[model samples]
Target: MTKTPPGLPLRDYAALGDGRTVALVAPNGRVDWLPLPNLDSVPVFARILDEETGGSVELVPREAYESSRRYVEKTNVLETTFTTASGVARVTDAMVTGVAGRLPWAEFARRVDGLEGSVEFTWRISPGTMLGTRSPWLDRVGEHTIIRCGQLSMAVVGSDHGPASSDPTSADPAELHGHFATTAGSRHLLVLTATEGEPLRVPDPAKVDEGIDRTIDSWLTWSDEFSYEGPWSEQVQRSALALKLLIHSPTGAIAAAATTSLPENPAGGKNWDYRFAWIRDLAYTAHSLTWFGLREETHAAISWLLRTIREQGPDVLVMYSLGGSTCAGVVEYDVPGWRGIGPVVTGNPAQGQLQLGIYGDLIAISRTYVDDGNLLDVETARLLAKVADKVCDEWRSRDAGMWELEDEQHYTSSKMGCWQALTDAIALADGAHINGDVARWRAERDRIHDWTDEHCWSEDLASYVMHPGSDRLDASVLLHAPSGFDRGERMSSTIDALTRELGAGHLLYRYSGVADEEHTFVACAFWRVSALACVGRHDEAVAAMGALVTQTNDVGLLAETVAAGDGAFWGNLPQGLSHLALINAALMIKDLAPKEAHDDQ
Candidate 1:
């Protein structure tokens, strides 16, 4: 057996999904990160987080080889080609879907095809411990190899295109194994079918293999619906496709990112579980999907978000599960994290923090929905009004800002969010889409605007600062441009200040001091694109957007952060906010307004 490399870089993984759960396939044919049943659930294969006991499906050429991969045109299905000394093999990987949509259970398929000459291969299936639960064990029902982990059961099936070998059930680290060789035009496959608390059903190996093309067709059909033709059009479409993978089709809830604990700082304790749906992300997604005119995901996401917020809210939350549950508790494992960065964790602590910006997120979603020829349901409208009222009452208090920091303060961005929320609420009330105390909402909105101007703006830095105490410039304040807080002299100057303080070439750190501790936030740079266009810097926005799109991996998927110095991916895979920001920024740049009209508000 080839010794496992100490680690695989996050950039080396490609994502595949069925709009249900995501699986990250490493460059060398390893299924490194996948959560069962759902994206936020305990992972079935998570060698990305915990290298040793965190299991993976390993398939690699038996000889020294170099590999390259790309998504099958406009689809999430990945095709990786391995070139060995004597031959070549192509592997197609997908999380298959039925004709109707996502399968009731998860189905992951990997088809191996010989491209030239003949290539030898080996494969193994080792299901790991269920997060904090008992270790998995293998069983056999007829010829199917079933691995049981906690309440879940997975069937690992393979078909031979050559002679094979299998491990005895007594094997400790792995119980299912096979080896084979393929010549030109030859085909073989390995399929995994999983379910929780349901009857185990093993699929015919051929049918599972055929499901790869079926999944491809499904993704192509979905991708064809994207009508966006703009700057970064291909990346925009790919971002749309990547964002589609983060949508939990069963409930229409969008996860912030696919996996957890991938790390914003590899050497520090900044790794987080980003598998839940943040209200901020939902609002951003709803806003971005409008440009593509995708009705299903847009409506489903908006409806799911408001419904979940209504069920669990009077005071809004930062995030909720794809299943709409608000009860997420943090759990840390005793396993080594990515690259021996220990204390890998699940369930973010930020869920319970009072992030005041969620008010803006909810109201921003409502505004976008109504503006797009849609009307808010009466209950949803009422809930939004209640949020407006709460914002009016609580805008004075300090709370966790959009960054979800432990140090609660009246962050300028949070105040601007409150301002945007109340402003949008007044518009909704005037349009009769929602009923709110317009008089109070307007008064509170103006107060927030003036208060932010007086307290948050810094003469020394010539920018709206992170908070009153510090002169640090925050990239999040760039959202003020789209929120219509200011797109004039102050905003333009602030953009220049942020570009100098937080910008790292094409990327930008979240705030001033974070450059040394963490990588640049991917979404922040895209926000700079939108803010630039909003402030009449179209030439710069065009130039900036040109550089930022290349920051994504070759497969066109982005994580939450990127190392400014080396362009390595950080945080979690297929980050929703990053893609949403890309889509929105591209559209903003393409439809940028007359420069004269945007000059100095």
Candidate 2:
């Protein structure tokens, strides 16, 4: 098989989401990656993976043009401006939201507002299913153009003219190409509505236009509730907006990231689907949202997570499907991966991995919930107690660390996480939030802490090693300083050690061994920032944060990883964990910085 040429840099794409699904719009006006109906659904446009056979929705200029884009203030609505010698045009993109909740049908609206001299705008809709397993066909329903593949159907409406070209002679007959010329003061609108199992609803043009207004209004209203007024407030709000996009409004589950199978390592084989909600990521998201005074999203996310745990009977998997069901098994695609990184796979096998850090995550979220004055329902309380018991029973056993390493070890970070979980559990039990063996939890928590201090710390290295018997450094440990596991000189020294060993300027790899293989994990860098502030390295923390925030894409979205050498983005788009980390780190600096720092700003 021949490799497809690389697409645009990962930073060149901005995301648009309406609580259910996301579309990655390229600077060149192509909707290259969109999973219809839901974030985890089979892609209807997968050109980001296989640019050759995979399809896209293009609304690009016919001539070369300089482009720039940004999200409308406090919203996910994306506006891209193309400037050419002859003319300038702006395309406003949004996934039209409903008045009450998620719209019954998925509607992606793109409005073109001509800003200057005449410019020819060309567009095409070519649909493809997951891994190209299903073929899409075009059918004209009255004046509406419908594209159907298996159970999914999409209707293209709103443009005044019909498709300029259709491959009626081809077997699949999916491509619908068209073009229109617009001068200054002229405007055109295109809306694509996707539905599954139900009959296609070709939305009226005027209704779609109104829906766009409602979507923008809804986002603005949500933004109005933010109470953050600290350093980097704009970036914090933008990150919060990005995180809001990942929230599945129907179920309140927050996906780890919006796209699937974006490579972490430039050489490939490290790609995994991040569209499902990880318990750890959800807990972090809730914690960050709570700090921002965004109680609704935090409450909704925790409620959904607890409900899922209760239904699953407390033997919590690492992650769950957005609908709170068991995730399907991993399946490899026959297509080339992003940028010819081979073996594009869907579904994550890490769903069942015993990542012991989740115990700490759940307990941290529970602590935040109760501290915020929200009482836990009986079922959730019981679930928390049961999970705490499991942590107590399993803390001594070797398990996967937070990095989800394949080799199970007595990871020091995992032990610290369990220590954190049991400590919080005892606190909750004492507070009457749940009934548990407080005495036993206290004993185990102390023992875990003592064991970590004795074994994890390396006097030789002057830092905590990855595990008891290993010399490797893992960035996961940096999280503990802010988690309250260790905030003393030891952690301070560990921060220095981590920066000396694993830090690539302000970026960091997950562990020592993978530095040559994968991009630096963006979340870890932010964790370091938080760790620095925790240890009272205020100047260093502020400087580090300044450098890290500069890594965000043009529209303020961060991917999962970034190239250590050049700071280019890799991995999943609009990573929730990365954004959560950024928000938390900014808040940490704000709280820890001396009064002079704030006065200086």
Candidate 3:
């Protein structure tokens, strides 16, 4: 195993994806985590996980330097400027896409332009391990040098540096290395192209360089269509871009996060894989995408979800693979995790856990789509109608709640999920969008509301408990406040209780007992903002959201958890749910907050 450098904090890395796969780039110009061919595949660069064996495409200066970075306008393209004693160089990193969309083959381009005096730059390509299991071999095929690992083959083109051309004596050498000096106004291009299970081909470097601008333009053009003109507009757009990175364009499944097994706590074995699409996350993404008036992605995600649900109807898994198939069970990798945290995992085991809340989430998407004046096909309407019926049969059963907790209980939030599902279904039926037993749905909705109000409310805590008879408070209940179950005294008091119990300033832990295991959840904080708006705490909600947006990293990316004590990031990053929550909260605050009153003097 080749020795690798220390890993950077999650906050220092920015993501660049072509809507097919994402690459995490540190400020030091290293591509740390990139899954080849697709986002869920084995990573070609896993340096973030294992510093020793995990390989990276490293481009950095040899001398001492300092750096800063930002996205190029409204794009996922990352630009890092490195300044040294001799000069400065600006590096633009992109996972290039065609003008139409993602390319048939994977192409990652790094273009560096010197801005000042000449500065020496060094780079190395080390194909360390295929998802941290084995090493890849270096070979020269005809004119192009190839690195092969299992079914993946890659080549680096457009490097004129000396060592980049040197031949390797060993078939499995540690790395290919090189150095070049950049002068003012000089531009250098390095393109890494790969293919899986097919013949390898390389495009001209000049054309690949041209593709970078086209990719940036595509991102800008997509973002320009966003209709969000609310508070935190910049961060909301950044969150949208991050959410866009997680959407698998081909299948339209939104991944929960870009990487897996980033532990919520380093010492705790809570490193769950988040590569698969949780229907809950997909539903949230769909709702937020619709909120921003981005019609294409919203429709794509909704269509894919309903299509997949129809295929697995009468019973639905909590999660599915990016291909809309059953998830492969969990596999623990041999590689050490980031910072030597062990037991890195690949797949998720919660697919079979019955998260009853998905009924509400799934039905809500159809409601949003139909409410926007679009018509659902007969098949989708039937699928949702059946889901509502399934909710009738399943809501009484004790099952995993929205957190996918192991302990099954009569969760308040799950009941609220049923209530939301039935209420939406009743509305759809009233609108003639779906055919269902409207009277039955109405009765069940009322039953759920009555039962929840009776069993879940705590006289002492003044908020809904995590479950019946449990004294614990849950922040997830905030997700339902906007649905208007009560709109009066109970929800108002619950807001104060949640603020006192689960909140740390504007941030919030997931529930009562999780502070020891993880940090305050990013999405829960955003949910609190929405809940505040729903309950008429308009000024407080705006203030809380204003402070919450400050928690995002420099490039406006968020991880799953923000450490309650110190605000350090933990868990899987560029989290789609976190970004989705931010967008949704902004929209809610914009819609619900009162307009300024006119003054007549």
- Per lDDT, the best of the predicted structures is 2
RMSD of each: 3.0, 1.9, 2.7
| Residue range 1-601, candidate 1, lDDT tens digits | 9774477878888998888899999889999888888887888788887777788888899999999999999999999999999899999998989878888889988899999998999887777775546678766677655788888898877687343335554544444677889899999988888998899778888888777888899888988887976456789888988898888999999989998887787675987888889999988888888767898888999999889988897667889988998956889887777887756888889988887888998898889888889988889988988999999988888888988888889888999999999999999899989876799999899999999999999898899999997878789999989889999999999999998988889688899899878899999999999999999888899899999989988899898999888898888888889998888898887777565534522
Per-residue lDDT value at 93 in model 2: 95
Can you give the lDDT of residue 27 in candidate 3?
A: 87
Candidate 1: C-alpha RMSD after superposition: 3.0
Q: What does the lDDT read for residue 178 in candidate 1? A: 77
Q: lDDT per model, in order?
A: 0.86, 0.87, 0.87
* Order of models, best lDDT first: 2, 3, 1
Q: Name model 2 segments beyond 4 Å from true.
A: 1-4, 161-164, 170-172
Better of 1 and 2 by lDDT: 2
Candidate 2 positional error at 324, Å:
0.5
**TM-score of every candidate:** 0.96, 0.97, 0.97
Candidate 3 wrongly placed segments (more than 4 Å): 1-6, 159-174, 597-601
TM-score of 3: 0.97
Give one clash count per candidate, in the order shown.
0, 0, 0
Residue 441 lDDT in candidate 3: 88
